[model samples]
Target: MLKRIKPGQARLGMFIEAIEGSWADHPFWRNQFRLDRAKDVERLKSSHATAVIIDTDKGVDVALPIAMTERSSPHPRENLSLKRALRTIEQSKPLITEMFENARIGGTIPVSHAAQAVEHIAACMQDSGKALIEVTRLKARDEYTFLHSIAVSGLVVHLARAVGLDEKMIRDLGMGGLLHDIGKMRVPLKVLNKSAPLNDVEMGQVRLHPSHGYQLLAKQGDVPRVVLDICLHHHERIDGSGYPNGLFDKQISIAVRITSICDVYDALTSARAYKKAWNPRDAARLMLEQEGQFDRRLLMQLFHSLRL
Candidate 1:
């Protein structure tokens, strides 16, 4: 027999048939497992997983007193479970990857291609905001450009909704994130793939990508202003420390602020050839410590959305 119960209701001996949150948020590599350790139980309890599915026959049956409550996430809006959201992201990656590949060859980033990918992500966000953003962190080191675009777009969708932006504005923000790093496609693979620290000249070359990407998108003549802002300014820090442009304080728009947080968070947690991946929890903490580097409210909203 299988049953669903709140994460808090789970007991020590129960078999966790499926966790209801993103895999990035949990420690387990496999979804189905027996809860044999006290720490595992505690981790699940503290996780963003609102509910967990367990096999009564495979482990201990639910305790009588705890089994009587409703079997759903505390926030019922999370109708799309983590597993389903991950599947959606996986299916959407290749479409967006092809778009990036085209851009690398002097191809224009068709708004149509971006709309299809953002539509799919918006659909996933309608299911579960947390899963849509968190699950995309699971990607190969070589896929940073392709996957990072998708990840930031998804995060923008979540942030846009959280802040009550209208549908049109939200869509524009999503499009910007999907194409934010399109300029990197113009950067030489040798510099982008270097496994060691870059010299100043190399770093200078690397920083030109935003402008290069912006110029490419601008030529398309159909890119939205919000999308253009993100492409050119996602790297621009609030304190004037970022590259391509030293736009500081009010110069950075909310769209750029939201995208930047998602952008940095994904970059930190992702496994790059140059450095090992930081744990999601550690990445969130480090971002909080960077004063004047990010918008505080949007930064808090990113963590709150991820339940980290």
Candidate 2:
């Protein structure tokens, strides 16, 4: 069983399943570990995490006051819906993380596993689509890269449905969103996570992610063509200004166009190590201001579907 407790309640011998807050604010690299050292406990207590999830089956459990315990419980129906969404994201993280790590090590892409994750995300969106997006937006910096994929997958699934795409295409597009940024795994972490502005050379390396991701997925024989197109051309703009291919309007596919909109929207709204998160309304407004960068009709559809 997993229990959420305040960091001050953490003690030696407990197994931490996760820390709830920005990973940038914590000293530990790994989220899960057995709390054995006193200094580690002190460090966690002093960290920015507001809550910690401990696996009682693996180690000790902490006792909470009656009021605190009661406060954790919400109205059952609402709680279940939100919990279902949150649980799906938590479960999907390791799967996505492992897949990316495997890619980094020159392993094959697990298309079946990734498809299953997309299915799970789609189901959660069915129950609480808005809640799922809300939960994903709170991602910790440490897990941002992996969770961003899941978030984009959910957005793609939502937007695909909004535009009345058939079920098969929706799933395919969702898969595309999940693996669209796989190329970033090949870039150096220093460049991906640098707090300062990237120089021209660093920017060039960052821009190569699409081609890198495209080549990596192209090697996977069974991957769908739509997924391949999205992985490579998502960065391309309709005005022929984007990179790698620089194709003009009509040269880009509808699926790629949608992924590009969601990709940029999520990046804008998400809090990165270098910048604070933008409000949804403000992010949407800013995206609208960027001329020729995205498909206007699709962007408006996304805005309406998300009710932003």
- Best model number under lDDT: 2
Candidate 1, residue 256: how far the Cα is off, in Å: 0.6
lDDT of each: 0.77, 0.82
TM-score of each prediction: 0.72, 0.78
lDDT of 2 by residue, 208-248 (tens): 99998888888988888999999999999988999888989
- Residue-wise lDDT of candidate 1 within 1-308, one digit each (tens)? 78988776655456788877776666567778876544566577768876799986566555422122255444443333453554566566677777788778988666788888888888877865556554455444456677678778888888888988999999999999899998888888999989899999889888998898889888888889889899999999999999777999999999999999989998997767677668778999999999989999998987887778
In candidate 1, position 33 carries an lDDT of 85
Worst ten in a row by lDDT for model 2 = 63-72
Off by over 4 Å in 1: 1-83
